[model samples]
Target: MSDSPAGQAAQKNAPHTITLLQHNALKGFLLAAAGLFLFACMDSTTKYLTTHYNVPFVVAMRYIVHFLLMVMILAPRHSAQLVYTQRTGLVVARAVVLTIASLCMGMALHRMPLAETTAINFLAPTLVALLAGSMLGEKIGGWGWAAIVTGFIGVLLIARPGGGLDAVGIMFALGAAAANATYQLLSRLLASTEKAIALLFYTALLGSIIFGIALPWFWENEAPSELEVILLLSMGVSGGLGHYLFTLAYRHAPASMLAPTTYLQLLWAGLLGWIIFDTIPDSMSLIGMAIVAASGLIIAFKSH
Candidate 1:
């Protein structure tokens, strides 16, 4: 009954190992939940801004504030190197896509109900599943295909071709979904080798530059009030912080484990929309959201 050295070491480490695993799991769940909360908050803030301000002006200001905050936070730690990157093209592409997505989401927020816009954005995950198979050569099975189709159908239910279609709003939502899919796919490609902090730093820096150039065309005649400016600033800071937490979440657990939790954002969006604007979604909208959420949850579970 004598224990070997390796067995003794394993026994000694067992409790510590179990404790570490539990800590990581709890951290991942908390990070994922926080990320969702921040995202919902960003959407709510954007909706508020768009109600009273030009979409582009709000978007530009938000990115500018985000860029400045990132510089303030990361510059002391890593100077000009924040913009230095071997993947310059990839970085630029990510920035462009993200800026465009933000613009489109802003437009959607201006015109559509918040919950509906959030639900449509969730279509990005399904698009990511398909793109991973095609662009990244991942093996997505039959269930993945089914989920993609089901999710698209839910979008159609919301858009309602001829019934409730606000062509501009629907198009904006779709564009946002596409941009989000591209962003997620690029993140997956980079995550295998790049440091998460570096990736995020570059995204904020480049996004600021790209959006900065575009800001002149959309600048408003009147400056935003103090309260509007504060919300815009909060949006950028929260968005950047959320991205950081999400990166931490992935380090602790598989994406599949945390993916389904994103549906919680729809609920948050719905509640925010109701309270802030007294915007209650109709029965059809609720049903459409349910379909989208259920299909997305199934997709996340099946892919896992």
Candidate 2:
């Protein structure tokens, strides 16, 4: 209500600032959604590639190319911020966690269908909501708990006995889910001090080094065809771009609030699995996927 020049400037800028914030929120949501789809593409491609190569090699190639792409693109833009972080130990730990996730997911994809594998992984977001309270000090209400429980039930239906999914693959998928949940929580915590690019960079760096050393063990000496070459390279682009978008999204929005948006991954995975592999989830698994997605959506949108 002040009539001063500074006061008038503040008033004029208020609406613009509010509009900017809204635009960022919208952008973040779209990015998060698209990121998940790319992730589905990455996983589907991995599932296809794993049939021809070992898990470590597939993962190493993904990260090696990912690291190179970051150097070529993100490094120039972000400069030191891409290579440095206040939380050095935490950044390394987060990268290791993601590496574990990539390895587990790769192993799972070796035998599992893309849609089922991805639906199982959607448990990560619900698990994040469940753990946010204790790990990140974020509050979760009764509805959040309900959603988490529902998500578990959905996963159960998909992995139930006589469901035709491989037991080992299911176990690996569960491991990937746990690691991914931890990675998401760590990302949310680090976003306070670390730039998304820094977190992303360290992850690719660690993945590259860790898997690169073991590359000889799982090396495919026969050489890949043109299609295989494209798929291998696409993994890096999709993974790097997907995680960057997801990181930016969580930086702008709470991890829990952004949980529902990740369900788009289920849609993409199902579509890609069908199109690329000529596979579809059975009735039971489809129902389970629906149950899990609905629960996570309910939990995320409960307080939004």
Candidate 3:
């Protein structure tokens, strides 16, 4: 029988709605890809700067610029309330842990290939999955466990004895992974009670304060050239803007849909590493990265 006018109107609008949704998803994916590229650039810039500056100085400068950008970008809406939080202690701890993670990752990058260090750091999501049940009271099924195990195997492939990767860099990358996993877990816990801008501001403020205080002791005596200065500032600009783009991406797509796009960072890291430093991961290392990425993708799809 003929449908009512309301039913006909609803049917007419459904395809247009679906098209709009698909468009938004495509935009989100592009934003995520761009953010990953910017992040890769930030890492490459930090690695380059380490040749002339101490790790602490490079890290501090990035966060110092990050802090200034946060003030300009977030303060208008949040005002002094940018520092307010429901769980103050957790927020502070999250900032501290993330700072430590950056320091460790910086140290690793200074001594290792960008692809290798970045691959090892990919263990963070696996660690989060493994620890979530105990730490966050979340449940993980057999698939999650399998993915975690596979991820560790990938780590072993990259970091096995005599793999030609530096032992110190390997240790630093491992530390960064653990620290980052903890940071991710904490961020999840706080997401319910805290504003994203407020959390972002705290991390920027804390990173700057922590690293800036230590900057004096780690200062390089030689002055940087104007070009070096630009690159150094670019670290923060890229990092800050990359993070902004990353957050913006989730608005258009769910985390599950966006999660796999993060693996694009490995590609960006490899390209940047090759272009900037003339290095690429060897055959075994590439296989290891593939394993790590597969494991992470499984978890992302399953968790979604």
Candidates sorted by lDDT, best first: 2, 3, 1
- Model 1 agreement with the true structure over 1-304: per-residue lDDT tens digits: 0034664355355522311112255687788789888988998999998878788888777777877887888889877446544466776787678888988999988888898888888778777777776786655567756876887888778778654546798789989999987876676554433445666776677777877887889787887788987898998888888777775665565444455556778999999989998888777778888887787677666764
Best by TM-score: 2
State the number of backbone clashes in model 2: 0
Off by over 4 Å in 2: 1-25
Q: Residue 260 in model 3: shift from native, Å? A: 5.8
Please rank every candidate by TM-score, starting with the best: 2, 1, 3
Give the per-residue lDDT digits (tens) of candidate 3, residues 44-109: 999999878889999999999999977887688868557766678998998899899999999999
lDDT of 2 at 291: 94
How well does each candidate superpose onto the true structure, as a TM-score? 0.84, 0.90, 0.83
- RMSD after CA superposition, every candidate: 7.5, 6.1, 8.5
Residue 2 shift from truth in candidate 2, angstroms: 29
lDDT of each: 0.74, 0.85, 0.79
Per residue, candidate 2 scores C-alpha lDDT tens digits across 18-57 of 1111225577788899899889989988999999989899
> Per-prediction count of colliding residue pairs?
0, 0, 0
Better of 1 and 3 by TM-score: 1
